[model samples]
Target: MFDLNCNLRRGISRHYAIDKITDNHPIVKSSKKRIDKEYSKFAGILIDVFYDYLLVKNWEIYSDTIFADFTTEIYQSFQKYSGDIPPAARQIIGCMVDGDWLISYQHLDGVENALDRIDYRIRAKMGARIKLVDAMLILQRESIDLERDFHAFFPELQQHILNFSLG
Candidate 1:
């Protein structure tokens, strides 16, 4: 069952975040443009924060699957800072072990708004763009791995997600 109000695209996994694809909401449309403009600033912060974590976590030398996954994650995070794009928007991050798309497309409107607000604050504080793509890539890759492992280890948790509210 697809939850249109939530971020999930129809027929995808629970972890998916199908963001305003083919959407026509006026506010969301406007935010999309602004968010795209400031991705560098937000992505940069994510990269820097994740880079530090990578160094401490010692995942600098990750597997190709993991690295590719991470790289894709950073690429997708551009939408995150894009205020118009919902937090639950589905992103094509990497391949599952089986080669299907490992995507995230569930959006929490509140969470998405909060992230947008944070991005605004960061941009205002810095007064310039930030370029932390390297760090963001790593962080996203690791997160994907974490999600995969988590779901694998606790399949039962899916039930809770299914019942969660999108609003």
Candidate 2:
């Protein structure tokens, strides 16, 4: 299993540069809150939405270059934080990198396959079934809204990562 804590530590070490990351660091505290609010509880939906956003948005930052190259680099960087991710997620990561899945995830069939894989992994690793039908229904019904949300969310995330990297 990928270790979330370990990956977070690696991220902090790479970015925050605190002598030590304790429960007291603002980033650490904010991370906890953000994880609890956004990821810990709503990971699947957020992930799909984020994935869609990455694909559909214009992202002028990459106006002169191929976005696939950027995603390819990001995938390679995942090894730095590989400690915390689950084996299933690790498999998905491999598929994403090997398949250039960020671009593939933009297509309808790719989205379906991604959701199916997520559900399958959840069932296999957690012994819990996540009914993807409802999620799929939402995707079909609120795709526009979801795209708007992605447009709003992903750029900010990109900026944050960039700022963190530059810090």
Candidate 3:
């Protein structure tokens, strides 16, 4: 149990490390910059969600397993390890699974819904209003460049994770 806890902590640390790497990567920065100036402050957040959508959109290029099957396995894994996850994350996992969020990422409506939810949260927490829903228009307009950036960046991220795991 102690070893399991330590491993979980290590995994969480690796997750954050990977996020830092992604945030700092030049290609990701380029993708973020492609967003409209109105959304410059939320560029990082938008890029993160946009990349998830792209990953789902291009799932066949990256994974052999069907996307639905893959998402099912992920949800199951979350349930299996629910006891190890923090309470807040568990709640999020519940909502994610219930909403089929990962599967929904493949659709434009799902992406819009995600942006709307983020917009609401930002408004509530920061008392700052931004038209995040309109971000979909920018995403659609910049789809080609953003997709190209994702293709270039994702392989490098995968390699980095592999190296991190090996080290």
Clashing residue pairs in candidate 3 (N, C-alpha, C atoms within 3 angstroms) = none
Q: What TM-score fits each model?
A: 0.21, 0.56, 0.92
| Best-to-worst TM-score order | 3, 2, 1
lDDT of 1 by residue, 4-96 (tens): 434333324444322222123333233223333446335433432332343224333333345446646655554443454444443312222
Question: What's the lDDT for all of these models?
Answer: 0.37, 0.56, 0.89
Candidate 2 lDDT by residue in tens digits, 33-124: 33223234444443444445445455454356677777766787777666666798787787777877677655666666666666686678
Task: Report the C-alpha lDDT of model 3 over 91-161, residue by residue, as the tens digit.
Answer: 87898999998988989899998988788889989987687888899999999999999999998988898
**Segments of candidate 1 deviating more than 4 angstroms:** 1-121, 125-132, 140-147, 153-157, 164-167
Candidate 2 is scored at a TM of: 0.56
Q: Which candidate tops lDDT?
A: 3
The 10 consecutive residues of candidate 3 with the worst lDDT sum are: 1-10
Worst 10 residues of 1 by lDDT: 97-106
Worst window of 10 by summed lDDT in candidate 2: 30-39
